[model samples]
Structure formats: structure tokens, C-alpha cells
Target: MKQVHTRFPVMETERLQLRKIEVQDAENMLTYLQDPDVMEYYGLPPFVSAEQVLDEIAWYNKIFTQQTGIRWGITLKDEDKIIGSLGFLNWVPMHHRVDIGYELNQEYWGKGIASEALQAVLAYGFETMELERVQALIEPANLASIHLVEKHGFLREGLLRNYEYGNGKFDDLLMYAILKKDFLASSK
Candidate 1:
């Protein structure tokens, strides 16, 4: 399959744009990263400083540069301010698979921003990256996230009991996935 390394991919949907995360976005990223409500199921504790946010942004770049994954900052069509972020992680080109993750500013919750961003990223993953499967590991209690993935045609694989240890505890995660055939069939 093709790899994404020569250039960063920026995607646009009806109401949102998924672009590269930059240093200038640290403040905007910090807003949601520090929100307890936003980070509750995110596995990591709420970020407490700009330094942490910078490091997070750096990791976004690092992953892209290493050709392992990509993370895009989510912004409105007419704005550059990031309200959230999403993308593929743990990308394995040889295996044609990757794990997806995302987080939105609590203020924008229920506004369909995440859904728009997800559609764009999934298109890029399957079409451009030539991926066969995209997976998500979500906390079982994150009903909203579960609903989001379900809405996009991902099927629940099974419960991964105590699959992750984060935020000072072991957390159970529900595994979900959608293959290229599944996505294309749903698109039709």
C-alpha cells in the first residue's frame, strides 16, 4: 500500500477542515486537552500546561514524519482555531491497518463536527493510504464515541476487558473496526 510521508494531507468536509497540527495550535489544543470532561475517556489525564500541549503537538508531527501515523487539527471551514483533533495511529502499512482516535472540545459536542472530520479521515485512509482496516479502541463507558463509530458502520468486535491502564487505573475497552469493503459498501 501507499505510505503518507512526502507531504501532510489536509482534508476538508462540509463544515470542517482537518489540517496539520502546528505550534501555533498549542493554545487551542490546550483548551480541550485540559478539559476533564473531554479527557475523561481519553486515557490520559487532562493536560495542565502549555508545555504538555506542545509536546503533544510535537508527537503529532513526529508520527507523521516517521510515517507511522497522522493527526489532524480540526477547525471550521472559515477558521484556523482548532476545536479538536483526530486521525490514525499505530498505522501498519504492510498489514494495511491502523487505529483511529479523536477528541473534541466539549463546547462543540453534539454539533456533528467530529462526525464530519471522521468521514474525511476515513476516506483518506482507505482511498489514499490504501488501508484495508481501521480500528478503534474505546472505553466501554464512552457511549457517545461508541455511537459515533457505530453510525459510520464500524462493527463491534468484542470487549477487551482491562485492556488499558491509564489515569491510574485499568480500563475496559470495546474494540470496533471497519474494513475497506465495509466502508465502500456502506458508501454505496
Candidate 2:
């Protein structure tokens, strides 16, 4: 697999633009990251300061430089403000696998924005990244996210008991994944 480290890859969908997370996006990113409803299943506590969001933006850049993964800020085609973010994480080029994660503003829920963004990201992961598998670890109670991945043809693998710790105690996650072959077959 070729490492996309030299330049940030920018992608576009019919209604959205997936681009690098810039410092200018901090305020918009904070808008959703600070929303309790948006952060409920995000594993992190609601951000209370711009400084925390800045650190997050920095992390996005660091991961890209390290070639560990990439995170893209989601914005409307006609707007520059970030309304959400989605991307691959924990990338293991040797294993041809990575974890997918995303979050959107509560206001954008149920509008299919996430589904659209996810479709584009998955295509990039399997095609450009040459990923064999892309997995999403979603909280059991997040029915919306579960449905989103399932709609994209992700199969439920199993429960990962006490998989992650955040916002206080450990929580369980349901593992869902889609293989490159399956994705291509479905698209065809």
C-alpha cells in the first residue's frame, strides 16, 4: 500500500467536500464536539475550550504525517464551515486494515449527510488506500451509526466486551466490517 503522506488528499461528493482539517476549522469543529448529543457516542467528553479542539486538529495533522491515518473535515460544497468529520484511524499498512470513525452535528442528524460522506470515504480506503478491510467500532446503543454501516454493507462480527475506556468507565462496542472484495462486488 502506498502511504499518502506527502500531500493531503482532498475528496468531494455530490453535496460535500472532504478536506484536510485546518486550524481555521476549530470553531466549527468545536460547535459539534461541544454538543452533548453529538459527543454521546463519540467516546470523548464534550469539549469545553477552543484549546482542546486545537489539540485535536493538531492530532489530525500528526497522524497524517506519521502515515498512521487521515481525518477529513466535512463541509458543504458551497460552505467552508465544517459541520462534521470522518476518516480512517489506527491504520496498519502491513495488515491492510484500518478503523473508521465519524461524528456530525446533531442538527445534521437524519439528513443522510453522514451516509453520503461515509460512502466516499470507504471508496477511497478500498481504492486509493488499497485497504483489505475497513472496520467501525460503534457503541451498542448507537443504532443510527450501526444502521449507517450496515446500510453500507458492513457485517456485524461480534461484541468486543469492554473494548474502550472513555468519559469515565469502560464501554462495550460492536465490531462491524466490510471487505474490499465485498464492497466492490456490491458496488457492481
Candidate 3:
């Protein structure tokens, strides 16, 4: 595959805008990242400071410049605050594969924002990024996230034992994936 653009490409949906994570957006992003409920299934503990979010944003930019992967801040069209963040991590252009991850504010749960953002990213992964396979490794307990990926036609490939060691314990993860062909067919 060719090299991805160094700049984070902004993408927009009807109700949300997916753009590069700005330092100014840190506080808004912390509204969810620091929420215990929102970070329940996450491997890392809830963020305790805005500085942590700033570090995360810096990492996002670093990877984008390296052409590895990109993460976008999900913001409401009419609102200035970011409600969530989503993107592909661990991109392997040679293998045409990438891992997807995302988190949203609890307030936005069940409102379809996650779905909309995910669908747009999936389309871009397949069409724009020319990815053949996109995978999401979700904790088994995260039913909502599992459902979101399933709605996009991601198959439950397998359960990896002790997949991630975090929060003082080894966590099991359920791997879900969608192929370019399958996603395209389902979108029709």
C-alpha cells in the first residue's frame, strides 16, 4: 500500500465531525475519558488529569506524522465539545490490516453517534485507506461496543485468552473483524 497522508484528514457526518485532536479539546475529551463508566471496559484506568489527555493528543499527532494510523475527535456539529474519539491503531500497511478503537461519553450512548462515526471510519478504511481487514479487539463485557461492531457486519473471530494485561489483571478480548468485501456488500 502507498503511504497515508501525514496530516489527519477531517471527516464529517450529518451530526458529527471527525477531526484531528486539538490541545484545546482536552477538557471536553476528559469529560468522557475520566468517566468511570465510560472507561470501565478500557484497559487503562480513567484519566485523572487533563495533562494525560494532552499526552494522548500528542501521541495521536506523532503517529499521524509517522503515517502509522490516525485517531479523530468526535464532536457534535453544533457543539464545540468533543463527545468521543475513534480511530485505527497498529496499522500495518504491508498487510493491509489495522485495529480499530473508540470511546464515547455515556450521555451519548444509544443515540447512534458511535454507529455513525464507526460507519464513516469503516468506509474510509476500506475505500480511502485501501485496507483489506479492519479488526476491533473488545473486552467481552463491553456489550455495547460489541453490538456496534456487529451492526457493521464484523465477525466475532475468536476469544484471545489474557490478550491484554492491564488494570492489575490480564484481560480477555473478543476479536471482531470486517473485510473490505464484506463491508462493501453489506453497504449496498
lDDT (C-alpha, whole model) for all candidates = 0.92, 0.94, 0.92
Instruction: List RMSD in Å for every model shown.
Output: 1.0, 1.0, 1.0
Candidate 1 versus the native: TM-score? 0.97
Backbone clash pairs for candidate 1 read: none
Clashes of each: 0, 0, 0
Candidate 3 stretches with Cα past 4 Å from truth are: none
- Alpha carbon lDDT at 133, candidate 1: 99
- In lDDT terms, how accurate is model 1? 0.92
**Error in Å for residue 162 of model 1:** 1.3
- Runs off by more than 4 Å, candidate 1: none
- How far residue 2's Cα lies from its native spot in candidate 3, in Å, is 2.7
lDDT of 1 by residue, 1-188 (tens): 35565888877888888899999899989989999999999999999999999999889998898888999999999988999999999999999999999999999999999988898889899998899999999998899999999999999999999999998899999999999999999888
Error of 1 at 52 (Å): 0.3
The lDDT leader among the candidates is: 2
Ranking by lDDT: 2, 1, 3
Model 2 spans with C-alpha error above 4 angstroms? none
Can you write out model 2's per-residue Cα lDDT over 67-183, one digit (the tens) per residue? Answer: 889999999999988999999999999999999999998888999999999999999999888999999999999999999999999999999999999999999999999999999
Question: What pairs collide in candidate 2?
Answer: none
